[model samples]
Target: MSENVAPTASAPRSLHGWSTEFRATFTLAWPLVIAQVAQNALQASDVIMMGWLGPEALAAGALASSFLMPFFLFAAGVVGAVAPLTAQARGARDIKAIRRIVRQGFWAAILLAALLLPVVLQIRTVFSWIGQDPALAARAEEYIQIAVLMLFPALGVIVLRSFLSSFEATRVILVVTIGGVVVNAFGNYLLMFGNFGMPRLELRGAGIVIVLTNIFMLAAMLAYVLRHRRFRRFNVLIRFWKPDWPRFRELFHIGVPMGLTVLAEVGLFTAATMLMGRLGTDEVAAHAIALQCASLAFMVPLGLGVAATVRVGIAYGRQDREGVRKAGWTSFALGTGFMAVSALCFLLFGPAIVTIFLDPGVPENRHALALAASFLAIAGIFQLVDGAQVVAAHSLRGLSDTKIPMLMAIFGYWLVGLPIAYVMGFVFDWRGVGIWTGLACGLAFVAVLLVGRFAMRERLGLLDRIRL
Candidate 1:
């Protein structure tokens, strides 16, 4: 828990000129970006193939994924504490501590997966209670049930990925994740459409493909971690099954708030999606397409954010406050700059972007395509703030400061944002666009608040006091 440690390694190249720092950060970020995009592509493939089934299937798949994602993402976030902890231990050259962190990460993943799987199974009742289209809801429920079979393996992969990323060993993640996408896509083609003598199971088929992909990715990561020489020094695989309650408690202390923070943000999006469903299935489908575009672009900043967590955590571990500041600001700049270009693309080619998922030849899809285009344009306006907030949040996580940020997220997304989305989408009947704009406003608020808090922490010397 000490933050008074001397640097175990030489001063990092990140402590140099701004350009030097930028290059170093970008080097660490791009592989993470590729891995994230490839992972997202697995779901994108689902959306694309599901689109071939019709808007009802598209809506059903998107809604089910949205509902399940809150739990999945929350668990991933909790396990993600491994990255910052590993960075910190590396900074202090605390090999034993690093091993403990990884072991606890596995424990945390198992505990969270066990707790969440039952909730995933109850998707049908929740869908019904919310008065969703019963037929589509039934299909969505089946998808959730089958898809969640992968949750434990998926969680295992997250912990391993976080552990590897702390060493800046991301190429393996990128390769395996891209491989998973290929596997997922091929499996979906075979199962979903009854291609090559397979049953045309549609949503259920997609779920099965995801389960298989997760298993593959998990096995690949575990094999690499267990056998790779770079990881060998930590002895992570030796005596890995031993339980250490104090280490588990320490990880949970940092993880639970991180999990809630993630859930808060995802819950905001899911709530908006559910609200959109009330307007009609077509409306939900349109929202899904626009969101898909936004989510694709978002992986860039999200990757940078994870990299920033490692950089900042290392700096904090070395007790280098200046290094932490540089890492945070440099990452924010990189993330926001990329998002600016993405925003421009969204604004200039909204219709083109949305059409990639919908066939213009179909008269029914034309309305959804048009509406999706409009939503994309609104999505463009908030890209910069959205990017900034994520980097800021991750930077704070690097310092193991979670509780306040968790509260800030709840306040921004739920207390401030969701009400506005409700009033605008329903009360004003601006529908999907209105709901998205409200979500944007919430993101903007969080961006400003988090950046300001980091600045204040620096000025007040609170950064000197942070511990893990």
Candidate 2:
């Protein structure tokens, strides 16, 4: 928590130097981007394969996934503290701290899984209560139940991923993720379609394949960490089962708020998805398609956010204020710029993009396809603020400032965003467009607040005190 005097002359002092930081940031961020895209591709494959089964299948998967992913993100967020913790430790040349953080991260993952398991199991009943279609709810329930089986391994992968990514060893992450995508796509093909002499399981088959893929990914990540020559010196696998209560508590302290922050943001989006359901199947399916496209575009910035956390955490650990500033801003620039380009793609080719998810020959889907294209256009407009806010939030995470930002997310998403969405969609009768408009408003508020907070921290010289 103590601040050292600013580096006298060692730091870059000009825009040229800032450009160097941006280049370095991009180098670190692009692999993470690829890894994130690949992970999303896994889900996209699920949606695509499920689409082949029909709209109900797609809706069922989307609905169940909306409920399940918040829990996943919460667990991952809690465990994600490991990345910043490990990165800072590395920067400080404290291998023991790195080992301790990773070890405790596993404990955190276990506790979170135990706590979330029951909640994960009850989604079917919850869906019924929410007035979703009985048949759709039943299918969603079956899928959710099977998907719950993957939660433990999925979390284990999150923890291990944080450890691996902090070391900037993202190549292995990408390779494994690519493999997972292939495995999932192939598995879905065999199971969902009743190929290879198997009975058609449809939705249930998709869930099963997801579970299998998660297990394989966890196993692969564990194997790489345990035996890889690069990771051997850290002894990450040694004493692999020992309990460390104090560090576990520290991780929990950092992680719970992180989880809630993620929950606040993801929950808002999930809530929007649910609300869209009330507008009818066409609206919900269209929302899902457009959201999927937006989510894919989102991965680029999400990767940059991860990069920001590592780069800023490392700088923070070394007490290099300038390095921290440069890292955060460079990541923000890269993230926003990329999203701007993505927004252009979405705006210019939304119909073409929407077609990728829909079977054109299916007359039932034409309305949904057209609606999804419109949603994509709205999604494009929001991309700028969305990218900025997420990157800013991650930058704050890298600074180990989690709580205040969590509150900001709650305020932005719930107080500001949701109300507007409700009034516009229901009160004013704007429907799906109004709902997305509210989302844009929420993201814009969050972006402004978070960016301002970072700027304030820099201007007020409060970074060190906040670290305390």
lDDT of 1 at 31: 96
**TM-score of every candidate relative to the true structure:** 0.88, 0.88
lDDT of each: 0.86, 0.86
lDDT of 1 by residue, 1-468 (tens): 222234434433335666776887898889999998888788788889989888988999989998888889888888988988888888778999899889889989899999999988998899899888999899898788799988889999999999888888888999999999999999999988999999999999989999999999999998898788888778886687898888798788888899999889888888888899899988899998888889889999999999999988887777666678788899999999999999999999999888898999899999899999999998999899999999999998888877788888899999878988888888998988889989988999888888877767655455655432
Q: Tens digit of lDDT per residue, candidate 2, span 240-282?
A: 6887787787777777788998889887887898789899999
Give every collision pair in model 1: none
Clashes of each: 0, 0
